[model samples]
Target: LALRSLAFQMSPQELDLGPEKVPGPVWGALFETHDAGAPFSLLVLHDGTAHLYLSTGGGLIGSHGLSEVSQASQRFMTQANRLHHQARPSQDHPLPAAGMSSFYFLTYQGVLCYTAPEARLGDGHDQLSPLFHLARGVVAALESAHHHQSRHTPPAR
Candidate 1:
């Protein structure tokens, strides 16, 4: 499935179907970053399963499963829940322009979304800065874990 289509197609229940399961109401989030190269999307479930998709393939490219949710990821979810009121209910999941990022929250109610420039988010000038940074931190943790795993895995013949 196309990463952008996820906002319109994926449901919270579908996102909850992973190896790990969070015992509570199913919820999920999607973060899309548009840059000079292929757009990137990070889809995170309450279960701490994250799938990273690239526009080049229009499908899932990588997935990282967390044995336990990191503090930043948990905080990100909490902040997202609290800020849902600020996001407008969206049926159109528009792709942000280059250097911009779009965030989507999938709850029981429906899909909510907002977009902001990466610069503003990084500089803490955007209202969604807190959630943005927390998501970034989660991404960093995933990258670090992937790096560590690669180093330990034996090379294939």
Candidate 2:
């Protein structure tokens, strides 16, 4: 749904998410889509050091450093069945000693966003508030778009 909304409302331009220095045994993934005239991309990259970044072709927009935001985000995304994980070197850790996991969201205007929690396990939630709020707003926007679309579409024959 989020992807659909972005694809339908974003500009049709080339997105440049900048460069990444991913470490060995780790992989990065990028997802791109277009719909309703909107085009967007999501890039999840990790250096396999201690950082994971999310971007929309405009460089690093958000990141996670294995902190509380990471935990919370993981929990929420997992529950929502939107979290995608790669091979973990260990099962007990949220992230491997190297490598980073990717997450995605969007803005009200349909611009796509990527957020990866940083600051570590003990870090406060100040930075996370924006992410949470943005996600909430995006959800609302998606729902609203869905409702509007449903109302205008003709019934099946």
Candidate 3:
């Protein structure tokens, strides 16, 4: 649903899903043992700074943190280093607010996003990319899991 919503809102071509978005140290390869009571969800969004998760059957239950999550900072620095050489021609940008990696999650019909009004405001649409990225990633993961379960083949080994 999240991905669909994002897709509706913008084109996938504009979104970045490369390794930079979901780095190696983060989106684990482990099976991670299921809890078996109520299905849960976990993901790192916003260049991996924010951690998003939820565990509840109904009525909406979720949590998020703004810390670097180790992986995010590593990725951020790597990303910055890669882009440092590409100088902007004219437009100057104010630095974003001092804060850890921020993220937003949606649950039970509510959309939660983190925005620092005092922070750097780039293009009007920039603030929204994090939400769009998270939503799309989560939705795709969920759909893949569902497909794997339906097929009963262990999600392609």
On TM-score, the leading prediction is: 1
Give the lowest summed-lDDT range of ten residues in model 2. 87-96
Residue-pair clashes per candidate:
0, 10, 0
Candidate 1 segments exceeding 4 Å error: 1-8, 14-26, 35-37, 58-71
Model 2 residue pairs with clashes = 16-57, 17-57, 48-99, 63-116, 64-116, 64-117, 64-118, 65-117, 65-118, 67-120
Task: Give each model's whole-structure lDDT.
Answer: 0.69, 0.31, 0.31
Q: Write the per-residue lDDT of candidate 2 for residues 13-130, one digit (tens) a residue.
A: 2232122321221233233332233333333323211121222323222334524334443333322223222211221212112222223322122222233433321144533443
Q: Itemize residue pairs with steric clashes in candidate 1.
A: none
- Candidate 1 vs candidate 2: which has greater TM-score? 1
Candidate 2, residue 101: Cα displacement in angstroms equals: 14
Give per-residue lDDT, candidate 2, residue 116. 40
Tens digit per residue, CA lDDT, model 1, 64-154: 4554334546666777767766677888777667889888887676788888889999899988988888887767766766677789999
Error of 2 at 141 (Å): 0.7
Which is superior by TM-score, 1 or 3?
1
User: On a 0 to 100 scale, what is the lDDT of residue 92 in model 3?
Assistant: 23
Worst 10 residues of 3 by lDDT: 25-34
Ranking of all predicted structures according to TM-score, beginning with the best and ending with the worst: 1, 2, 3
